[model samples]
Target: MAIGDAQVDAADLETVAQQLGRTPRGTRAIASRCPSGHPNVVQTNPRLPDGTPFPTMFYLTCPKLNSLVSTLEGSGLMKEQTERLAEDPELAAAYQRAHESYLAERDAIESLGTQVTAGGMPSRVKCLHVHVAHALAKGPGVNPFGDEALALLREQALWPAGDCSAS
Candidate 1:
C-alpha cells in the first residue's frame, strides 16, 4: 500500500543522502514535505536494511530544518519544554499520547519490542529535533510538544522555507 503521496524514488533517496551526508537508514517514505516540495519528514523502519536497530520512526532529513532545530536545541528550549511537561498535567498526558502514537506508527511498519519513544516523550524533552520531526510527520494535534516547538519555530521565523534536499 502506498503511504500517502510520498513514494520514495531514487532521486528522493539521493536528495536525502546528500542532505544527511550519508545514506539514511530504514527510511521507508516521505511522511511530510517541505514547502518547496522536498522530502522533510520521513517514515523509517524500526530495523534498517543492514540489520541496524533504529528507534526513531519519523526521521527529519531536510538539512535546513535540521539546522534550525539544532539552533533551538542550543538555546535550551528542550529544557523548558521538559519543565513544562512536569508543570502541566494536560500537556504531559498529551505527550504520552504522542509517544503511543509514534510507537503505533513504528509498529505498523516493524515491531521494535522496546517502547523507547524518542525525544523523551511522556517524561522529558531531550531533543526538540525528534519532537519536531514527530509533529511534522504525524501532522498537528498528534504531538503537542512537537506542535508547540514548530509553532515557536514559525513564530521565530526559523522554519526552513526553501528546499534543503537539493543534490
Candidate 2:
C-alpha cells in the first residue's frame, strides 16, 4: 500500500499481537498511540536549548503519548509473521523480507542519533524517547527521526548529560 494508504487497525493489531504473544492490552495501547491521526512525519531543529522544542517537530497531528508508538505500530508486520514463519518456510521467508524492511528503517533512524547537539545540547539527549522528542520538537536540522525517531532511540542507552562546549 502507498504510505498514505497505510493505516493501523485495532483488529490487525490484535492479530499481530496474538502472533507475538503480547497481551491484548499491549496491542490496544500500541493502536491508541499511533491512531492514524497525522499524515506527515516530524523532524528536529538545529538549535534547541535544554532540548526544548525537541529540536524538531512534525506537521502531522500528534500521537497520544510520549512513547514511541510508530515503532511499535511498525513492528506489527514482524509480530504478525513470526509465528507463521516458525510453521511455514515460505511464510517465514516472506516475513524475513518484511522484517528486513523494518530493520532497515529502524537502523536508519537509529543512525541519526538525536543530532548530537553540535557539541551536545545544554541538556543532552539522554534516552531514546527524549532524543525522538527532541528530533520531533525541533524538526529537521537537529534530528531527522522526529517522533518516530525517538521511538527507535529509546531502545538504546541514554544520551550522556553534560556541557558540550566544555568537552
Clashes of each: 0, 27
Local distance difference test, each candidate: 0.81, 0.33
lDDT of 2: 0.33
Each prediction's TM-score versus the true structure: 0.90, 0.22
**Alpha carbon deviation, residue 47, candidate 1 (Å):** 0.3
lDDT of 1 by residue, 11-39 (tens): 87777788788986767787788988888
lDDT of model 2 at position 144: 26
Q: Where does candidate 2 have its weakest 10-residue lDDT segment?
A: 24-33
Candidate 1 clash figure, as a count: 0
